[model samples]
Target: MKLRMKSLAVVMGLLVLPGCQNMEAVSPWIDVGNQVVKNAGYDTDSKLARGIKETLYTSTDRASTGLSQVGAFNLSLPSAARPVADGLRQFGLGSYVDQLQDAMNRGAEQAVAEAAPVFKQAITGMTVNDALGIVRGSDTAATDYFRRQTEAALRLRYQPIVEENLRKTGFYEQYKGLLAAYEKLPVAGKPELDLERYVIDQSMAKLFTRIGEEETLIRKDPVARGSLLIGQVFGGAEG
Candidate 1:
């Protein structure tokens, strides 16, 4: 009876061992398991949402800063306007072309810097279904989600800034000058372009591209996961 009692006491002590003993190493999974139902993928919806939001926050910040630099949006003239641009280049009026391209890039760079708040708002407002789809879907799922949710708003926000910056940079006058020179040449087609819309569209596309790259990095590179919650949620860290 004494031996049995002693063994029972040892088992009880082991059972009551504090959960905090290796908490730094164990807490992430513990928190996950408490709320998760252990699906094949094994993540709580809330944790998944939090992890994705964190990832987007990091992605947006990095992309915005990187894309806001000089020459960051080194976009070419629109394809529709290519003939016009080529004609100007042939006529030795290339300075107008250079000035116009530079102005578009400058406007895009300035407008992209304002995108973080819009991205954050979209991340904050994602639905449970949206989070789940992002976690289980393609590599660019989060980027796609951002596009769907915030593209219109981002375009609306970006247009005025881009227009203002373009005006400040004399893009309109340079573009008109380029067109006038191109019209004087024997360019085959009268190339039409919505210059401001083109700039906004190109900038948004590049911004999404950067964001997609970040999402791919976060999913593939453990170092890019950036937090215990993200690692456990996305990287399958079992407790």
Candidate 2:
């Protein structure tokens, strides 16, 4: 589907506002939009579902694309493994550590690509009941629903891609070499971590964060009300 980039770009800009981040701020836009749809000879249920799905697609597209860039994941070695990482750096092997960090982030970036199809399928499956509930629900209601529908499936799909990218980036080899170096240290503690699982989990968490931000923008940002139907469904009621 063709994304309405003009609309989504406005929504993205609105997200930078502190007030737009308030998940508890209520607005009557959705109700007004619903009324408008009702009066426009459009079936409220179908229009609501389509509008939400279209919005979600734009949101998910932005999230996935933004996250695919290098350094986008912004994660580091877990705290438990920090000592080991520090030790590696102390031995002038810090570049290796940096490489591993970049690899993990890159892996996660690649893994995020899996989310698009999953979200598309999930959004496509959205029920009229789901649409009604989301329209009447909290600011993040749509995001919450999207998460419930896609989280498990996303995890299952993200892991292998993450693992593959990690290997491609030589993270495993560098990690093992670092661990070998750390073992030679006179330290009594060995830091253990599941890097693959960590990347998968963090990637999913960040993906949801992006989606939630978009959902909130749609609910609260007047500029996000782009299309005629979208504006009608999300615009404020002129009292």
Candidate 3:
């Protein structure tokens, strides 16, 4: 009986010892990081919407180059609309340049509004596999996927609006002016600017930049760890 009691005491002592307790390390950082990604993706969608809106409102150039005949016109006219005609003359176009700018901006704004929700859903639904693939692929692969998936549907939805805006804003007449100007220029092989496509591409590029920023944070920030798997996979310390 004495021997058995001594053995039991030893077993109990071993069980109670801190090092023998088989404790696992718990990391809160991963969870925090995941939540941050989700939130940032959502926030990025909002920023995308705002950026599109601002770009439309403030943009004077149909090409979105920030410097254009329209901007020059605005500066020259200052108060009156006469510089618009002068701008057309400088470009050797007709009186339709101003109208084209308006039409392009309107189309861009509408396209962004229609596409924002789809983009948000895509970002929020991104899986670990998707993130990993993005990390492994080209710098813009994630953004490219988002664009590929969304562009067709968005273009289909946006085309009618763009067409209507173009007609309403007299884009045909504006294009005539542009064509006239183009004919006078020595430059050849002028690439056609598909306004809807350009707007969508630019927006996707911006969204990718935002997603990449969040991803970088997830990779670097220990406090953003949101899961046991993530902690186990990424955390260097033995649990």
Candidate lDDT scores, in order, read 0.71, 0.69, 0.42
Candidate 3: tens digits of C-alpha lDDT, residues 60-133? 12222221223221211122334655777698775465566566556545544565555555555555555434
lDDT value, candidate 3, whole model: 0.42
Clashes of 3: 10
Please give, for residues 1-239, the per-residue lDDT of candidate 1 as tens digits: 67655543343233222322333444454444434343333335666687778878877788889999997877888888788789999999888788778878898998999898898889889887777666655667788888899998999889988777667655577666776786688767666576788899899999999988987777665334556555554554332
Deviation from native of the Cα of residue 191 in model 3, angstroms: 3.5
The candidates, ranked best first by lDDT, are 1, 2, 3
Collision count of model 2:
2
Please list the Cα RMSD from the true structure of every candidate, rounded to 1 decimal place. 9.7, 8.8, 15.3
Instruction: Give me the runs in candidate 2 sitting further than 4 Å from their true place.
Output: 1-42, 169-192, 222-226, 237-239
- C-alpha lDDT (0 to 100) for residue 228 of candidate 1: 56
* Best-matching candidate per TM-score: 2
| Model 3 residue pairs with clashes | 29-223, 29-224, 29-225, 30-224, 30-225, 30-226, 31-225, 31-226, 32-224, 33-224
Every model's TM-score: 0.72, 0.73, 0.40
lDDT of 2 by residue, 1-239 (tens): 12444443333233222232332343244344445545544355676576667667777787788898777878898788799789988999998778777878888988897678888899888898787667666666788898999988988888888777667665567765776787687877656467877788888889889877876776565345434444434553211
Off by over 4 Å in 3: 1-87, 90-95, 121-128, 135-141, 171-190, 193-239
